[model samples]
Target: MFAGAGSNLSQQFNLPFWVGTFGCAMLTILVSFMDFKKITRVLGIFTPIIIVMIFIICAYTFVGKTYDYEALDTVAQTIKSPMPNVFLAVINYYSLCAISAVSMAFVLGGSVVRIGVAEKGGLVGGTVIGLIITCATVTLFANIDNVKDADIPMLQIVKNISPVFSFVYSLTIFALIFNTAFSLFYAFAKRFAGRNKKKLRTVLCISVTIGFCLSFCGFKNLVALMYPILGYIGMLLLAVLLITWIKEKKNILAENLIRKKMIHLAVKKYDEDLDYTKKDKALFHRLGEKSVVDTEEIKSEIKNFVKETGTENLKPSEPESQSQSSDSANN
Candidate 1:
């Protein structure tokens, strides 16, 4: 992204490409030192700006431009895609995306107050990303002939609409690229350095320097070479996560079954003495739903309830025949 952003700026402004690259590296280093909350706030502000820009560009091209489905088909055949197949391309793209998502997930997971919040965040984030990708793909195919050979096709599309719009969009694109680089690099450095501030700074500097040197490999070429490889690694990560989740779910289901049986048995054992109501049963059912439950602890709790309520001395009512015999003897 750094390489692509810098390449675009250099082309648009007629400046040295290396200058833009160096600037991104310096900005990344400075931004990396700031608190994560500050960085998140900045990204939060730009996210809406990006969404609006993308929508305007897509809507404009679709409304104003001529639709050449025949030309699009021909271009699709003529152009050589980076991936061999569409399925592989999608997987590679998502895998590469998962790297950033996972990185931020780790960082932000700590601040989450509830599992529901995290789940909601993932849902909304995934939906937004899907919409953006779908719109971009539609726009690209809608104007395939025009952007087929362009390095940064989105910018080309915007530039056709207006140079001023192109310039503003370029700044937005740069901030987004910076956001990605800063997140990945910061996460890497934090992981390696742990809680050591001095070491983290050193790691960040070294990583950014190395990344800057690599940006000379031309944005397109680097993406073509690196993204798929990362995607494969990301697939492995995803597989591992899926397997772990399945195992955990199985364990949870087993625990729930055991808890249900235990609660039923405890309730039945004292049914004659203790008056267990619908509310009490609901409470016991809830205890079974927790992540962890101890049968022994539950038994002790039931015993304590019996003692506290004076149910321990309570006995089952005598049969009618026994009661009648006692009454006759007394008479």
Candidate 2:
């Protein structure tokens, strides 16, 4: 899956090295949504065995070679003969770097999830980080000449250390690869199933077969070409995310301002209406006091009419009658 996709991406992007890496990553994500439980089970059982095999092969090959044997001797000589502590140191260093990388990835994943960008950012960040670490480690420590010539530098490193260490290292590598492959396979399966069940089986078989064929090209060369391209793609995605977030923030701010203005207008209108009603009531009471008909009596009549008829009755058009009564009183 990785190789075919990587090659395709490389050709498409005109970046044979990094684009291919990005393609492999995309393929992995595409596969992760499939049968997770089954994939996990397979990986759990297969990883250790693969690692052991890798370690043994690497160890035997490196140790059997006269140059590598001399290289180990040279390393030993440089370090003033092999010490038990040296082996421990090497293991500790490997363990530290591996653990740190995994821990950082988890932290980054959690952060992206918190920011609501888990689907977009988390995958990109994780892939870029993974590629960076892989490439850096291979370039830095893996014997340059041997790495180019040999199938696996890590296996050689293991062989240089000891058969047991080599086995352990191989196991670790196998586990990592298995986990990655399974994740990709599962994603692809899930995606295919959701889209079309009838075609799912066919898609899975073809994808896996293609990926397996690509894997034979060896892991190191693939990583060398794929990592940088992925990093660049990741940067582009990050820029897009930032722009989107900014736009969303602006929209939210505008909406909030509109909401606030609406609320203020509603409250102001309500207050004005309340004041108007109060003034009208006071005027009504004053007019009632000066009139022949009591205000309370008029109100009682209106209420009674409303109760009987199930409708509001006016107090009667008394404006003209009140004016005439006042004039007559004046005369």
Candidate 3:
């Protein structure tokens, strides 16, 4: 992203690529020192603008450009892919993108207090992203002959549309790149430095400087070499997470079963000990005399007991008489 942003700046301003690259790297380092809330605030401002610009660019291209259907299949077949299998290639690409956003997702998820809100956010976010990608892909493929050799294809497409659109879209693309770069580096620093502000700043300086030097490799070269490797690594990480989640769900189910059993035992004990006082009678009468045990009260008591004594000690004990009889029969 740093390389891509630098390329955008160089093309837009007619400046040396290194100068733009260095400027972007320094700006990113400065952003790393800002408070996380402020960083998110900056992102919040640009996100909607970028989204709108992307759709506009796509719409313009779709309206203005005509795709060569006959040539489309030929171009697609001739184009080289990082992965040989098309399905796996798509999976790898998406996995790489998911890995990039996973840390930010964690940060955002932490702030959500309600399951419903998180569910809605995830659904809407995924749908919008998918739509954007679909639009952009169709637009790009439509202009494949023009952009197959270009450094930044989307910029070329927008520039061809109009100078005004080109300028605005360039700024939007830069912001989009900055948003990604900032989030990635911020997450990296936070993961290693934890809550240590000083160490975080230090890591940011070193990492961004290293990244700037590496960006000298040029954008296309970096993408060609880096993305596929990251995609494979992301796939491995995703597999591990899926396995861990399955194991966690199994453990939760087992624990829930044990908890339910404990609650049932506790409820039976409570029902047996009731004195059948007026209060109990009134409760039974209100409940139609079908049952007197308050299952909810039993569940709450079991939860408290587990908190105090732990689940290891919550197993029901056998009756002493039953144990003695079993022992005599064995003898």
Candidate 4:
């Protein structure tokens, strides 16, 4: 979060930019060495911490008096962006996030998506989550005058509640960063590690070293630069996905039609062959001797009749035995 390759320990006196980044990278390396079962248990810690942090922040803000009630009221009337801009932004943001979540689960490597959250049918909860965050953000807007120029506005807001609360927030941020780094780098290393435990450490070390050097570019600048590019790329990806889905559906429908036609033709052919056998045998019996009687010439007539009238319904049936009677022998 600090602008440099690492945290600015001299200025912040806590987690400097470089130290925090490197720390996360180190934790990621540690996680790569761990077996999957251990990783699941490790992930279980993130939810509780996030829940507690959000509840704490929400509770404090709800109880505290707004610094400027007028600014809070004005936020309701303010137009942050044009309606089209907002619609596209929301669509692009959530779709990209969903894709990233899927990709990460895939990269974790295995049949099971270990870190994936199984979604329930309803999405009403997502609306509630948004409302809660937005309400707090609106409240913060009332005090934006105080933090408009600060490096971390939330820190300033939390510190105002209590220094103790600020420290707790700090620790929460640390845990979140470490968890993110661990998941990402573990996935990255796993791809190249390829079941070679001996080479994993070396690969992880190389990844960390490269990342540590990149930290000098500054996190804030990198985020500012990448976001617009990523958004455009995400939109393009969504378009491609939609087109592919449409093509697949069309192909499936065409295949189904072809299959049905083939099945109908096969059934009709079977009926024609059965009718011809019946006619030929009857002619043979008429002469009172076994003889070849061809009925193939009438095949087209049977087919035309079937086409106009349609076939009978098919069902499973048992064979019925026929007994030769004295009347049949005379014929």
lDDT for each residue of candidate 3 in 228-289, tens digit (9 for 90 to 100): 99898889888987898687876545434333444334333344442335543333233221
Q: Model 1: per-residue lDDT, tens digit, 24-129? A: 8898888777787777887778888999998998899778557768878888788877788989999888888997668768777544423345667889989999
lDDT of 3: 0.71
Report the Cα lDDT for candidate 1: 0.73
In model 4, what are the clashing residue pairs, if there are any? 5-215, 6-17, 6-18, 7-16, 7-17, 7-18, 8-16, 8-17
Rank by lDDT (best first): 1, 3, 4, 2
lDDT of 1 at 157: 86
Say which prediction, candidate 1 or candidate 3, comes out ahead on TM-score: 1
TM-score of 3: 0.72
Q: What is the TM-score of each predicted model, taking all chains together?
A: 0.74, 0.36, 0.72, 0.57
Best by TM-score: 1
lDDT, candidates in the order shown: 0.73, 0.45, 0.71, 0.52
User: TM-score of the candidate numbered 1?
Assistant: 0.74
Runs with alpha carbons beyond 4 Å of true place in candidate 1: 64-66, 249-331
Q: Which residue window of length 10 is worst by lDDT in model 2?
A: 259-268
Q: Tell how far residue 310 is off in model 3, in angstroms.
A: 36
Alpha-carbon runs more than 4 Å astray in model 4: 1-15, 64-92, 107-136, 139-142, 192-202, 238-331
lDDT-better candidate, 3 vs 4: 3
Instruction: Mark the regions of model 3 whose C-alpha exceeds 4 Å error after superposition.
Output: 64-66, 249-331
Whole-structure CA lDDT of model 2: 0.45
